[model samples]
Target: MKHPYSPGRVLCALHFTLTVFLLVRGRPKFLWFRPLSPEKLMDAIAQLGVCFLKLAQVLATRADFFPLEYLDKLKTIHDQVSPMNAEEYEKVFARAFPDPSCFSFFDSAPLASASIGQVHEARLQSGERVAVKLRRQGVDRLVEKDIRLLRGILWLAQPLFSRLTRNSLEAVISEFSDMIRRETDMLSECENLEQFRKRFVKSDVTLPEAYRELTSSDALVMSFIDGVRIDDKEAIGAMGIDGEKLISKLVVFYMEQMLIAGFFHADPHPGNLLVQKGGRLALLDFGMVKRLSNATRIAMIEVVKAANERDFELYILACKRLGVVAADAPDDKMTEFAERIFDIFGDARLSASSMRDIAFTTLASMRDLPFKIPQEVVYVMRVSSLIEGLGTTFVDNFNGVKDVLPVLKSNLTRALGAEAGLFPTIGQELAGLPLTMRRAKTVFNDLAEQNLHVKLSRETLDLLEGRIRNMMRPICQGGLFILAAFLVVGMELPWKNEIAVLLFAVGALRIVIGLK
Candidate 1:
């Protein structure tokens, strides 16, 4: 079906096309003209309205997909847009409520405005204070038109940027469009609030209660939360709140959300988080949230475990499992890529700035490597990076790696129960058991026949050591078992067989030690 064209759609297309052109041009050809900067690109996207602004916000989280300069500029794109006039707001509110007197008191001026909606402070007929969030009139039609125009542009440009298209650009846009459409539906935001409230019922974090009776697809009402902005450290201190402790609590809360609950607030920018009295955290804005599937969760845990252990090879493996890297990627290339990642993050304390640097460098280098983060996990990465950013603002010398481990460990224990204690190490060994046994059997048969004269070159030993260093705990355990079995089967003499028995005992001891 053919769609009608609008000025908003035309303007968005023109702006996006020009931005892409300028970005691709890189440098100015004319002597008098200066090259377009990242800031200019950000401004252009912001001008495209809420959808593009939200897109820029999502892009900002992808440290691994974009350059640091672009990321830095994109992160500053605020949701606060021009507010609708009182007359326009009244029309929108009337459409949703159909009763001007539904609220005893309604502010003519919006408390805050964003691309999709504007919020106002109001009092219910029952005298309760609430925030009324109303979608901008005709925003849905505009968004739909713009998205259709965007898809058409992408279709036309698919051949020019086949690589990007191959990377699932269309899929990403579709997901983003779906998300924004949901955002336009205030009911979805209310549901998000309820889910978060339920999830955090026992935690120190607080969420505004949704007024379902007053909510609809276009309008939402929730109990207003009174708190200081979380990033306003001076304000928090003036209120006698320990900013550092609150920051720590914030970190732990997010950790529990992501690692334990597998659900999290996707947009945790400073404005969305507020510090209430007694240093309690008040979370607001549930327009964007993400839920991680079990497989994705496991992949993230594996990546963290590998990074914590400094196992570059295992890190590569985890990335492969996460579909960030192709399964058939050359081992040497994967190793090199992993080495580069470790070099970036290995010694650096885990802070927002450091992570941004790592993501920028790693992604920049990926032009030559086979790497692509899955769309499903993009929000996860974004939320993680956001946490780091918030942490740096809240605490000095904040080490995310140090802080995240205990939370991860505790959540993993709860998730895995008693068996959770044996992880990648034992898991790896069991997975490789059959292959290890086969290799050991061949060695034992050769040795028993007196046909085996083992000789090791320094280079070969070095390679073996490298493999051992990169091996998972389970693989190491299996290697010991293999060695002990080979010794027992290969030895003919009583004394030598006794030594083999001792080796077997030692291997058993190693397994027990690993368990302990």
Candidate 2:
């Protein structure tokens, strides 16, 4: 069946693609092309509306994917998105609460607005204060259309990317599509809130109570959360909360989410996190959440253990198991990558900015190698990066690697499903000893037979060859001029001078044309 394409979607997709294309062409290597300014790119994304704004929020967390200037602009996108107008707000409220008597009083103004919904402070008939989350009118349909448009664009460009790159791109789009679609459903968010409440019931971390009786598909009513925004350092200090303790507690809570529970709140921006009196943390907005499979979680544990132990081979193996590094990635190159990674984490004294610089540099180099970050790790990285950003706001010289590695190392036993008993852990390791030995033996045998294969896919080889050719062209041109000069000076033939001039002319022409 043929589907009708709207003009608006067509224009949006074209603008999105052109902006990205310009950004790529504006890289340092493309000297002839005019550079795309970060401000222009951010403006373009903002014009694309809420769906793209959400994407920009995720992209902002990726220091490796963009320059620092671009990251700075992207970080501001989510907070700056415009809220719904009065007419739209009234329409949604009416549809969500047809009875009109559910709330005794609802403020006309929203307390906060986001890409998917807006939150308003209201009071129930019993005089209890609540925050009502109202979904934007037709937002679900808008999300669906936007995702379809994005998916179509990606499908058209699939043949241009390598298999590994294609897989990673597809995984990202798929993850975002599923996440945003689910986010439009207020019921699912309510359930997520309830699940978190149950999980963290014993912890000092606070969660607002969900009013399931009052929630509907378009609106969710919950107990209002009151506190200072986590980033408001002055307010926190005035409230007599220890900044250091709050930072430590935040790290510990995230450690429980990522390393132990395997399920976590994906969005940890400052606005979503609050610090109540006595250093109690209140987490808000559960619309965006992520879960790690058992395999992925265990592989992450292995990655942490390998990094802490400085085991290069183990690190690469863990990366492979986590679906980040290709299984057939060359061993020597993987070792180099592992070394670069270890250097980033080795120094506890490195500040967040310095560590970020090292990490970004390493990742920029990795782009040329056979590496792909999986969908599962995308949000994990985002959460870590966002939390790291938060930590930097209050704590001096905060580094995520320094903070997380210790917590991960200490919780390895519990994360591995072993109780706080040495015997069970020993038994578990002994049970896997034979398999581990067999794998080691196989690797050694391959090395002995000189069968350590290096498989660079055709696309990667082509790209590398292209870069090499470009590099050698300039040298080859200079060599030609030298040869021509040598012939003119040394040879006595009548045509020698003519030949040298022709050679020089040809080389000069080639150089001139190459500049374009």
* Top candidate, metric TM-score: 2
> Whose lDDT is greatest here?
2
What does the lDDT come to for candidate 1?
0.71
Model 2 lDDT-worst window of ten: 24-33
Query: What clash count goes with each model?
Result: 2, 0
- Model 1 clash pairs? 425-474, 429-474
Model 2 Cα lDDT, one tens digit per residue, 305-373: 888788888888788778777666777889888787667766777766787688777877776577766
Cα deviation of 515, candidate 1, in Å: 49
lDDT by residue (343-415, candidate 1, tens digit) is 5453446654775566565666665565555676667766776776676675543444555444555555544
User: What TM-score quantifies how close candidate 2 is to the native fold?
Assistant: 0.77
TM-score of 1: 0.72
